[model samples]
Target: MQNQWLVAYTSPKTEKKIYGRLLELDIDAFLPLQKVTRQWSDRKKVVEVPLFPNYLFVKITQQERWKVLSQRGVIKFLSHGGVPCSVPENQVRAIKDLICEQEVEIYGSSSLCKGERVVIVKGPLMGFEGFLTEKKGKMRLVVRLSSISQSISIEICESHVEKIYG
Candidate 1:
């Protein structure tokens, strides 16, 4: 009974439904949600939405994938090289760790500005931390993943960033 993470794609806005079904079947699942503050015609509100729309994580055996495959609202697992993709348990664990301890925040701002104090985890850049700065006259936000002395810039906020801070 080895544990594996599979990417489950669902119909638009069906993430919650898929999550519930997985839970009912006693499957472990994860969905990273982002907290956003939005303004409506009459008021402001804080909303939590999926970071990756139409996706959810399910922990199951390869033999059990077909059961989930037939579940309502499910599209299928992601694939590469023409094979179904299986996410690593460690990767899922790390994302869960971030969900537990991350403080990065993102909000609507003036046409793509810089942020401050980003903490990085994972990759050759593991344990990397730095401040974010904008490239001259560009709307893209860059985070100096290392530091000022000798560092490189990586584009964030427009990519698959797990989290952002205030």
Candidate 2:
């Protein structure tokens, strides 16, 4: 079977640990990390934390699924109707690209601003769809995939996107 990107649910606060275990087993995995400041009694410290809590992405074939599940921290594959669902390559790539962006923001579905649907007409993320939200005179494209329950906002040129009607 061909290799596909699958989402793996892990134990609480075990995303980084599971990512490491997958790597040791020669499995390709991704754990998106973002920088945030944490407050303490004495001082505040900046740290890199998992962008998606308790979730990790892994690239593996059908034959390799069991190997990943057998790992200590992994709970199970995210499945629908008793079958593992594969994430589209474009969506996965978009997430990776978002992580590398300097002017990027991540938000849960509840907080996304309302706007017209749009697609990137040009640039590396061409064809990505999401609600367009503007803040402080800066235009951004917010991409939300309901299946993932997470949204990403990336700064884009106003001319590079066009409104799309449903």
Candidate 3:
């Protein structure tokens, strides 16, 4: 394959299951994960967990895509023209870098929901680099700091958040 990454859009919330299945099926797959440690209000506890909830990256030959499609939790490859599309290597590498540096732990769906990058302006959280998400009928701007891999998401009002690059 000319590309190293393919997007595996799995059944919702079945990301981990698919990751394990892919490995079991001997497919070189990676479900990009961010370790997060969240504590309950009355507890001094934390847990490491994944950031992206339902996506995984797979390294497969074009010929082996059918094998991937046969996996139980896999839905379909991200595609165009009815042919599976390869995810850009740099994008996959960026995900790897985030995982390697542990930068992804604090970053959540809201942080990178609008493609891969964004610029932030307005609010007390100004100058904080982050991403946006449209959820529950609102636009959320989130900044995830590595301190706890904890993200602060606020419903964005009238603000200046623009994509610098995608």
Candidate 4:
């Protein structure tokens, strides 16, 4: 079977470690991270933290699924009704492109109600598709990563995106 992107749930705080292991084993993986300024009692430091906690995306064929599961930190692939869920390539590409911008926010998939489907037609996010939402009186584009029940929202200009009509 051809390789497909699957979401791997990992042990808490082990995302980076498991990602490294996947890399060492020559398995293709993606772990989205964002740089944030963390405050400590003594000092402040900027660190790169996983955008989606406890989740990593792996590209593998059906036969390779077991190999991924054999890794120490991996719990299992995200699934529905005992069947592994594969993520669309376009969504993955949209995420990679979305992270290049600085104002992204992560949200639990359940928190936001579905809104209008839209595709960015201008600016850096051109061609990225997501739902249009309004929060705190500002419009944002929300990209839902359904396999893992998480979504990422980025504030966007209304002119930058157009509604996707049926």
Candidate 5:
């Protein structure tokens, strides 16, 4: 079977551990991390945290599924109905690229309102399509990963996007 990208739902707070184990097994895995500032009573510090809590991506063939499941802390692959759902490669690449840029925000799929579908006409994320939303009075282009029900939003100029009409 050809290798495909799959989302793994892991135990709470175990993403980093499972990612390491997957690496040791020579399995390809991706855990998107973001640097955030945390304030303590005494001081403030920056740390890298998982972009999607309790989730990570793995590239594997059908035969390697068992090897991934055998890892501790991994619950199971994200599935719809009874079959595993695979994420599109471009969506994965969009997430990877977006995270590297500043002023990016992550949102749960539940909070987003349905808006006009648009494609970025200009900018580093050109050709990326997502819903346009106004949140807190800022224009945001939201790229959603439907399989995981999560979205990555970034501020964009109105002129940078062109609405898609059916």
Candidate 6:
């Protein structure tokens, strides 16, 4: 059976634990982590924390879906119409890429929910298209992908995009 990338909702603060379990079960799993420094009373330490709190991604086939859900700390697969949905490969890659980025921001669903559809006409992200939303003096290209039911925003220059005809 073919496997597809899917998102799973996990118990609070158990993202890493679930990821490890999947690995033990020979299931392909990914938990994007970001480096953050925390300050204690007398010391500071750098730690890798889950980028998306309480969420984990796994590559599994339909027959293996139930196995993932049965893992401890795993709540359920993010689904629609009672069917588990697979996240687009490109969206998965974007999240993976963002984890290595030194500066990035994750916004709520409302922030980029509406705007004009635009395509990047220049720069490294040339040909990228999404809803363009301007915030805090910065222009962001927000791409909303189904399956995950989440939108990711990438910083872009206002001059690099032009409107697209339907």
Question: Candidate 6 overall Cα lDDT vs. reference?
Answer: 0.76
Clash-forming residue pairs, model 3: 36-49
Where is the poorest 10-residue window by lDDT in model 5?
Answer: 104-113
* Model 3: per-residue Cα lDDT over 90-141, one tens digit each: 5455446445641112233343454345665643444456676656645565
Q: How high is the lDDT of residue 126 in model 6?
A: 54
Q: How much lDDT does each candidate structure score? A: 0.62, 0.78, 0.62, 0.81, 0.81, 0.76
Could you tell me which residue pairs clash in candidate 2?
A: none
Runs of candidate 6 with Cα error greater than 4 angstroms are 101-143, 153-166
The digit string of per-residue lDDT tens for model 1 on 1-166 reads 6867778888998888788888888888888776779999999999987766887888888788887889899987877766767765555664565455543333444533465555555443344464556555332323341111123344433223333455
Q: What is the lDDT of residue 98 in candidate 4?
A: 64
User: Which scores higher on lDDT, 1 or 6?
Assistant: 6
Error of 1 at 155 (Å): 12
Candidate 4: 10-residue stretch with minimal lDDT: 104-113
Alpha-carbon shift of residue 91 in model 6 (angstroms): 1.9
- Over 117-160, each residue of candidate 4 has an lDDT whose tens digit, in order, gives 88878655577679967787655787666667898778765666
| lDDT per residue as tens, model 2, 1-166 | 7899998988888898889888998899999888889999999999988887888999999999999899888888888888887888777886787678654332324433348787777655678787877777555787776556677667766666677866
lDDT of 5 by residue, 1-166 (tens): 8999999999999999999999999999999998889999999999999999998999999899999998889899999997888988877776787677664432334433348798888666678789977788655788776868887777766666777889
Per-candidate RMSD, Å: 9.4, 5.0, 9.9, 5.7, 5.3, 5.7
| TM values, all candidates | 0.64, 0.79, 0.56, 0.77, 0.79, 0.70
Pairs that clash in candidate 1: 104-164, 104-165, 105-164, 105-165
The lowest-lDDT stretch of 10 consecutive residues in candidate 2 is: 104-113
Better of 3 and 4 by TM-score: 4
